[model samples]
Target chain A: AQSVTQLDSQVPVFEEAPVELRCNYSSSVSVYLFWYVQYPNQGLQLLLKYLSGSTLVESINGFEAEFNKSQTSFHLRKPSVHISDTAEYFCAVSDARGGGSNYKLTFGKGTLLTVNP
Target chain B: DAGVTQSPTHLIKTRGQQVTLRCSPKSGHDTVSWYQQALGQGPQFIFQYYEEEERQRGNFPDRFSGHQFPNYSSELNVNALLLGDSALYLCASSLGGSGNTIYFGEGSWLTVV
Candidate 1:
């Protein structure tokens, strides 16, 4: 079984300010990490993922996250946020299946980011 | 080029009544997964269907069941629904059977009265 914990329920930041959303997970086996964003009443959109390359992975929209194994953390960060970035962000984990037929993701409660203009 | 789509964008049902939700996978996709999202909570996996067979399921009860058609579309049927069942139901699709990231639909909001 795998579980994800997002420490903050809400975060408020002014436009152009940096922000970091914390996420931690507990899993017995190797896992794949992912970040997803959900806009108002919309579906979840993939932000970035960490699957075993460099410890850090970045999204095209200037968001990035670092997977810290020792700390059991995968925190999402952005140097400066735009108003359009305001949304709910969720952290997910799927058990690593080197060769399996199906894999499902375990998600966090989500952090609501509010970027004030 | 169509993404995952769900029907009856919003629904209202009475307690103890049953409801059926539908989902259509993205074009060229063969796998479909369902999830339940409650207010202020993350989405919970319901099940996954591939090749018209149930491949994986979550911790939900037997009261919740589903089926997949030959067209790769799916449906979730909840029997004896309770107020707790009122939540956003999300459907996702992936290209292959597994190891691929799931893409989600806007979700259907079910309100139980």
Candidate 2:
């Protein structure tokens, strides 16, 4: 079984300030990490993912997450925040079992990020 | 191209009743997965369908069932629903392969009363 832990349940930040959302995971096998954001009354949107080759992955919207194997962490970071960035963020992991089950994402409880102007 | 889409944006059901939610995968995608996101919780995988077959399942009980048609559209059915069954049902689609990016629909809100 694989599990993801998002350390914070809610994060408040002022616009243009830096923010980080911490996530940690436990898995028996190699894992793929992902970050998903959900706005109010909407579904999840993939922000970025870490499959291979690089430990750091970035999203088009200026968010980035670094996958740390030693610490079992995949913390998301953004240098500046915007009110539009306010949303609930989730951390997910899938084992390297591959095949049909590779898409079975195990998600974290989610962290609600509220950006203030 | 259209992304994943789900029907019955919101609905209310009584205990012991049955509910069926539908989904249409993104264009050209062949695999579909169902997830249940309870209030204030992360979405939990319910099952996945590929090639019109149940390719994988999660820890959910048999009360939660699903089907995929030749067109790659799918339905999620829950029988004998309980208050705990209230959740946001999410449908995700992706090509049947490892590392392929999966896309999610806006989701159907189910309120069990």
Candidate 3:
């Protein structure tokens, strides 16, 4: 079985400050990584994903995550964040070998990012 | 294009009663997956449907069941609901392939008392 661990439960930072949300996973085989954001009373939106080729992936909202194979980590980072970035972020993983409709994702508990003015 | 959509945005039910939730997958998506999100917890996979068949399921009890229609829409039915069943039920859709991006709906909020 595969699982994701997000070390931070809550991270508070001032607006325009840089932040990093840590994530680690445990899997026997290679896996695809993804980051999702959820705002209050809304569904999740994909921030970015790391399927293959590039280890570093960026989202249009100035957020990025780097997939480190050996370390089993895909930490999300931003040089600066806006108040609109405040939300709960989740790290998820799925087996790279699992194809077709059999694919399923395992997600972390989630990290709440609060950007204050 | 419209994203995934779920019906009965909010519902209240009593224990031992049954409840049903509906979902319409995003355009161009063939696979629909259901998830349960408890308060303050990440979404937990319930099952996935493709070609009108269940392709994958999570560790849920028999009380939890689902169906997919020919149009790729899906429904989640819960029998003998427990207080613990009260949560946000999310529906997601994706292309039937490995490493494909999955889009989620706002979710149906169920309250079991």
Candidate 4:
């Protein structure tokens, strides 16, 4: 079984400021980590994922996350956030042993990021 | 390409009643999964369907069920619903195999009274 914990329930930052959403996971086996963003009245959109490769993965929208194995953390960060970046961010994990896509994902409670101008 | 799509954007039902939600997987995808998102919480996996059969399921009870069609579309049926069942139901689709990305729909909002 896998579980995710988001350290913060809400984060408020001014536009152009940096922000980070903390996430930690507990799993008996290796896992795939993902960050998903849900805008108002919209579905969850994949922001970035850490399947395998470098410990750091970046999204097209300037968001990035680093997978820290020792700390069991995958924290999402952005240097300069825009008002459009305000959304609910969720951290999810799936068992690496599942061996394929469409595997079950365990998600955190979620962190609401509000970017103020 | 059309992304995962779900039907009945929002619906209201009473306790002990049953409700059915539908989903159309993304184009060229053969796998569909269902999730439930409660207020102020993240989505929880309900089940996954492949090839018209259920392949994986989560910790949910048997009252929650689903079916996959030949066209890769799916339907989620919840029986004897309780107020706790009021939540957003999401449908996701992905190709059946390794290295595929799963996509989600906007979700259907179900309110149980």
Best DockQ among the predictions, by candidate number: 4
All models, RMSD in angstroms: 1.3, 1.0, 1.2, 0.8
Model 1 Cα shift for residue B111 (angstroms):
0.1
What TM-score would each prediction reach against the true structure? Answer: 0.97, 0.98, 0.98, 0.98
DockQ of 3: 0.63
Which 10 consecutive residues of model 4 chain A have the lowest summed lDDT?
Answer: A95-104
Worst 10 contiguous positions by lDDT, candidate 3 chain A? A96-105
lDDT of 2 by residue, A1-117 (tens): 899999999999999999999999999898899999999999999999988888989999999999999999999999999999999999999876654235799999999999999
- Model 4 Cα lDDT, one tens digit per residue, B74-94: 999999999999999999999
Which residue pairs collide, candidate 3?
none
- Kindly report the root-mean-square deviation of model 3 from the true structure over all alpha carbons: 1.2
| Candidate 1 lDDT by residue in tens digits, A11-93 | 99999999999999999988889999999999899899888879999999999999999999999999999999999999999
Question: What is the CAPRI rating of model 4's predicted complex?
Answer: medium
Q: In order, what lDDT does every prediction score?
A: 0.93, 0.94, 0.93, 0.94
Worst 10 residues of 2 chain A by lDDT: A94-103
The candidate 2 chain B region of ten consecutive residues with least summed lDDT is B94-103
Q: What residue pairs are clashing in model 4?
A: none
Q: Is the docking of candidate 1 incorrect, acceptable, medium or high quality?
A: medium
Question: lDDT per residue, candidate 2, B71-108, as tens digits?
Answer: 99999999999999999999999987788888999999
Cα deviation of A73 in candidate 3 (Å)?
Answer: 0.4
Q: How would you order the candidates by DockQ, starting with the best?
A: 4, 2, 3, 1
Off by over 4 Å in 4: none
